[model samples]
Target: MADNQLGEFLRARRGAVSPDTVGVPAHGARRVAGLRREEVAVLAGVNADYYARLEQGRERRPSAQVLDALGHALRLDPDARAHLHRLAGTAPVLPLGRTPDRVSPALRRLLDGFPGSPAYVVNRTLDVLAANTLAEVLHSPFSDLDNLARMTFLDPAGRRFHTRWDRTAQAVVGHLRESSGLDPDSPRLRALVRTLCADSPDFAGLWHTHTVRGKTHDAKHFLHPDVGPLTLTYLALDVRDAPGQQLIVYQAEPSGPDAEALALLAALA
Candidate 1:
C-alpha cells in the first residue's frame, strides 16, 4: 500500500481549507493555510492523535464511517468522495493492472455522424483515442493531440485553447486522480504521472492534492486562432462497453453567437 500517498492527500486537503471557511472563528494569526489538525479532528468526530496517525501513514486502512465523516468534514463533492473511497480500498472494484486503449468501430461511426457538434473519446489517462471531424477542426492546430492531459499542461497553446486554463488544468489533474485511485497499478497512468510531475510544476502540484473531478455537463470557453472565440456546453458519457473510455460531446446553445461560430468553423473544415 502507498501509505505516503494517502498521507500527502490528507495534508493537501487540510491545507486547502481555512478555519473561517468552515465556520470556525479565528483567534489569532495562523501559519498553515487551512484548518489545523485539531480542528479537522474535532469536526470529523475523531481525536487529533488518531487523525495525525492516519495522515502520517501509520493508519493504512480507515473504516467506512471514519472516511465518510472525514469526507463531510473536508466538504468533498461526490466525485471526490468516490475517489476517497477508491483510495481507501472501499470502492466496488480495484483493477489489478493496465487496461486496454482501443476504440471500437461502432463508436467511431457514431462520432463521424456529428458534423456540427464536436465529439471525441478519451481513456482514463485522458488520451484522445478517437475524435470526429468537427472536433479536429475546432481544436485547430494542437502542438500535441495524443493525450488530453499532456496537451492541457505541456502544449504551448493550452492556455489559449482552454481559455479558463487554471480551472481546466486542475480538472484534468482531478480526472487523472479519479482514474489512478481506481486502477493504481496502471503502468500507462503511472508513466504519465511521472512524466508530468517531472516536467510541469502545475501538473505536479495538482496531482498531489488527490482532488478528483469527473467531467459532467458544463460550460466551456475556447479561443480558437481561426474562429476567434467560442462558448459551448459539453457532456461526458461513459462508454458502457469500454471500462476506461468516455464519449464527450460539445455543442453550442442553439440561436447563440457560439452556434454561429460552430457553423462557420464547420464550413471552413
Candidate 2:
C-alpha cells in the first residue's frame, strides 16, 4: 500500500482540473499544472493552509462534509468521490487477496443458465475467475483468459477483438483505479498495475489520469474472428456472496444480426 495514497490522489486530481473549467481566470502563463493550491482551497471553501496540509499528508482526517467539498472542487464523478472517501479512511474498506478462486456453485450454475448470452465472473483484478462455455468461446482470440487488463493492452489480438479498443482500455483502467482505492494493501493488485504501467504506454497514460469507475451496464462492441462484428449490451452485478466479485452477463438485441453472431459463438461453444 502507498504510504500516502490520499495525498497522491489529491495531487493527481488537483493537477487534472483546469483553471478555466472552474472559472479561475488565466491572465498570464502559469507554472502550475492544473488548479493552483489556493484556487482549490477557495473553491472548496477551506483555508489554503488546511488544504495544502491535506495534500501534504499533514492532515489525515477530514470530515465527510469537507471531503464532499473537496470532491466538488476536484469535479470528481460519483465513483471518484466514493474513492476519495475510501482513501481518506472514511468508507468501508473491501477485503482483498481472499479466496478469489472460490466461485459459488449456485453462481456457476447461473452462468450455465445463460446459454444464449455470454456470462462470466471476475474479481477485483479483472481476472476471469469463472466463465461459461459461450463466454470462453467469445473470448477465444485472447491467448489466455487469465487477465482482462493484459489481454486488452498487451495482447496483439486485443485491438482486433475489441472494436472499441480505446473505450475498453479507458474502462479497464478506471475500474482498476476503483479497485486500488478499495484494496490498497493488495500486493497482487499493485503488482498487476505496475506491470501494466511498465509494459503498456497506453495503460500508463490512463493509469496516471486517476480516473475511477466501477463496471456497470454498458454496450460493448466486438469483432469475433469467426462471427464477424457484434454489438452487445452487458450488465455487471455485484456478487453478494463474494465481496470483490462481479457477475457480468452479455446479451445482444433479440433477433438482430448481433444476436446471430452471438449464437454462432454459442454453437461453437
Candidate 3:
C-alpha cells in the first residue's frame, strides 16, 4: 500500500515492539506510536540521523553489517531478519518474480524416495507445490481445501487440526508477511491476503500486527480424524539453488502413538 515498502515494514515492526520488551524504559509520553528514531539508533548502535534517513527512504540500501545490527536491535526472529535483509536489499536476489510451484524432476524424485516420511514442497507463500503419497494422506484436508494460508485462516478444519491453533495461525501469518516483504507486488500473495482479510477477522488482526518469521523447526500437534492426535516434529529444508522453495518433512517420535498413527496413515495412503 505504501510507496516505500521498506519504510512501511520498519514502521510496522517498530510499532509491534514495546520498549519494555527491549529493556528500554518508557520514561515519558511519546509523540510517535512506537520507539523514536533516536531510541532505535541507540539500540542498533548507529547514528540517529542515519537511522532516520533510512526510515525516511532517503538511504535506499543498507550494508549487511548494518542490517544485522538492526535485526539484533529489533529482536527479530529468523524470518523477520530475512524480511529485514530483503527490505534492505542485502539478501540475495532471486529470479525476478519466479514462482517455484512447478516441481523439478529431481525434486519430484526426492519426494518419491521418502516413503517413510510425509513430505511436501512449498513455495515462499506456503503453497503446496508437490507431495508424496504419504504427504497427500497426511495433508488430505489441506489439499482439498487449497492454499495453506487460506486453510489456516478460513477453514474450521484447520482450527480443529492444529493443537496450538492460535500460535500456529500466528506463525502462518508471520511467514506470509515475510514473503510479502521479499516480493511486495506479488499478485497472488496480495490477492490471498486480501481474500483472507475480507473473510477472517482473526487473520485480519494478525496481519495488521506485521509479524515475520522464518520456517524454523517446530513441534506440531495434529488431531487426525482417523489416527487420533499426532505429535510430530517438522524439519524445513531449503532447496539448494532455489531461493524460496522449501522441503518440509514431518516425522513422528519413535515408538510413540504419533509414530503408530503415522504408520497407519502411511498404510492407509
Candidate 4:
C-alpha cells in the first residue's frame, strides 16, 4: 500500500545487509534498522546527502555509475542489481502499462522438442503465457494456473507442491516485487497485488518487506504427488523479442531419480 517504493526497497535491503558482512565495524548496541545513511554513502563512494535523497525519492534518476556503486555497496546479486538500475530509471523500460501477450511459435516448437523437460514461458508479471505438456503436469496442482504469484500465495496446495514452501513463497514474492518496480503502473499486476493483499495476510506482510529478486536459479526442489520428489536444474532466459517474457526451462539428469520420475509421469500422461 505504501507507494514510496524506492525508499521502501532501499530501507528493506539495507536492513538485510549487516555492517559486519560488508567489513563495516559493528559498533555498540545500535538502535537502527540497518546501516546508517552515512555508512551506505561511505561504502558506495557517494555523498551521504545524495544517497539519502535517492532513498527519499527526491532524486529518482541516478547515473549508471552511481547505481552500480550502490548495488555493489549493498552486496546485491545480479538480479537485485538489475532491479536497482530499473528502479533508478537507468534501464531501457517499456511504457509502464504495456505487457507482451505473444510467445513465438518457434519457441513453442522448441518446448515441444523437450518432451522430458518441464518448460514454460512467463511474462514480467509471471502469467503462464505458454507451456509444454511436461510443464503443465509439473504445475497440475493449480486448478487454473493463470499466474505463478497467485498459485504461490493464494493456493493452499502450494504448501504441498513446493518442498521448501516458505522459501519458494519468499522467492516468488520477491520476483513479483521486482516486477512491480519494472512496471509500476501495470493494471494487471496492480490488480493481482491488490487481490492478494486483501485475500492473504501472508502476501501483504511479504509485500511490505520490499525484497526485490527474480528467478536466477541453477536448481529447484519439488515434492510432487505422483513423482514423489524431484530436483531439477532450472534456467530462466529472457525472451529478447518479447521484452517482458522469459523462457523458463527445467531439466533432470539422464538416468537419475528425477529423470525416472519424469519418465513415469510422461508414461502416465
Candidate 5:
C-alpha cells in the first residue's frame, strides 16, 4: 500500500474528473488534464493552499463536512464518496489485519442447499473461502479457485470462462479498491495486490484507476466448456456475523435456457 493513500486517491480522482462535466470552461490548451487545483478548491469551497496541503499529505485529517464537499467536487458516487471519507480518516475504519478465514456452518449449509445454483463465499480479498459443489464445477476451468484475482488475471482459462472479460476485470479491481479502503493494513490483501501487479499488466493498469465498488446483484455471463454459454443473475449478500464475508449465489431463471445449462452442469457436478 502507498504511504499517502489519501493524497493518491485525491490526485487520481481529480485527474479522472472532466473540466467540462463540472462546468469549468476550458479556456485554451492546458498543460495538465482534468481540473486544475485552484478549480477544485473553488468547486470544493476551500482555500487553494489548504486543498494543496491536503493533496501533498501535509494535512491528513479533514472534517466530514469538508470531505463531503470534496466528494461532491470530485463527482464521486456513493461508494467512491465513502472511499474518499475513509481515505480522509473521517469514516469509521474496520479492525486492522486480516478477517477470519473460516466460513460459518450456517453459510456452508446455505451453499449446500443451493444444489441447482452456483454459490460461494468470498472475503473482501475475493478468496474463495467456501463453495458449493455447483460452484466448484462452474469454476473448474481455473487452475486454482483459491483467489478470484489470481484466477482472473493469472489463469488462462479466466478469459475463456468469463464471457465479458473486460467488465469482470473492472469489477474485480473495483472490489479490491473498496476492500483496501476499509482495511488498509491487511497483509494478505497487500501481498495479493503485489503479486497481481507484478504478474499481470492488465491488473496493474486497472489497479491504478482506484475504482471502488462491492459485489452486489448483477447478471453474470459465462462460457462453460461442457454447458456452452450460461447466463446467471447473482446476489451478493454480506454475512451479518462476518464483517467482510460476502456470500454470492448465482441463479438462472426457471424454465429458461440458462437454467437448463445450469441443470446440466449441476448433473455433471
Candidate 6:
C-alpha cells in the first residue's frame, strides 16, 4: 500500500479519475499525474495546506463535514464514502480473512423454507457467505467461486451466463471500486483486486473507471445451461442484526418461463 491509509486511498482514487470528471480542464503540460493536490483542495473547499497535510498523512483526523466535502469533490458514491471513513479510522474495523459472522439461524431457516426462490448472503466484498440449496443450484457456476466480483470478471462462462454481461461487469467493477473506498486496508480485498486485475484485462480496464455503486435492487437475466434464459428480480436486504452481511433474494416473475425455470432449478436442488 502507500505510506498512510488516507494517502494511499487518495492516490489510488485520484489516478482512477480523470481531470474532466471533476470539471477541471485537461490542460496540456500538466506536471503531476491526475488531479493536482491544490486542484482537489480547491474543489473540496478546503485549504490547500490542509488537503496536502491529509494526503501526505501528516494530518490523521478530519471532521465528518470535511470528509463529506472531500467525498463530494471526488464524486464518491456511498461505498467510496464509507471506505474513506474507514481509512480515516471513522468506521469500525471489520474482521479479517473470510471469517464472516455466521448467518442467523432465522435467516438460514428462512432460506430453507423458501425452497422456491434462490437466496444467499454476501459480505461487503461480495464474498459468498452462505447459500440455500436452491441458490447453490441456481448459481452453480458462481457457487464454486468465492468472490462474485472476481467471478464476474474472470470467469469465461460468466460472459454467457450473464445475459447483460457487459453491464453486469461494469456494475461489479463499480461495486468493487466503491468497496475500495470503505475498506482500503483490507489485505484480502486488495489481494483479490490485484489477482483479478492481473488475470483479466477487462477487470483492469473497468477498475480504471473509478465508478462506485451499491448492490441496490436490480433485474438479472440468466442463461442457465439447463433451464434456458430466465429473468429475475434481485433484492438486497441488509441483515438487520448482521452488520456487514446482506441477504440477496432472487425471484422470478409469476407464471412465466422464469417461474418455470425456478421450479426446475428447485427440483434439481
- Model 2 reaches what TM-score against the true structure? 0.95
| TM agreement with the true structure for every prediction | 0.94, 0.95, 0.86, 0.89, 0.96, 0.77
Candidate 1 Cα misplacement greater than 4 A, ranges: 1-3, 93-98
Model 2, residue 171: distance off in Å is 0.7
lDDT of 3 by residue, 1-269 (tens): 35566776777777767888888888779777767778888999999999888878888788889888888887788777888888778885456656667878999999988897988888877888888999878766653635678778877788888878998999899888878877777778888888888999999888877788778689988888888888889999988767688998999999888889999998998
Per-residue lDDT value at 91 in model 5: 84
Per-residue CA lDDT of candidate 4, range 99-217, in tens? 68888999889889888788999987889999989888888877777788888888877878888877878888888988887887788888989999999899888887778787766
Best of the two (1, 6) by lDDT: 1
Per-residue error for 48 in candidate 5, Å, reads 1.2
Q: What is the C-alpha lDDT of each candidate?
A: 0.85, 0.91, 0.82, 0.83, 0.91, 0.79
TM-score result, candidate 3: 0.86
Model 5 agreement with the true structure over 174-197: per-residue lDDT tens digits: 999998888998898999999999
Q: What is the lDDT of candidate 4?
A: 0.83
Q: What lDDT, from 0 to 1, does candidate 3 have?
A: 0.82
Best by TM-score: 5
lDDT of predicted model 2? 0.91
lDDT of 6 at 143: 42
Higher-scoring candidate on TM-score, 1 or 4: 1
> Candidate 5's C-alpha lDDT?
0.91
Each model's total of backbone clashes: 1, 0, 2, 0, 0, 2
Clashes by residue pair, model 6: 83-181, 83-182
TM-score of 4: 0.89
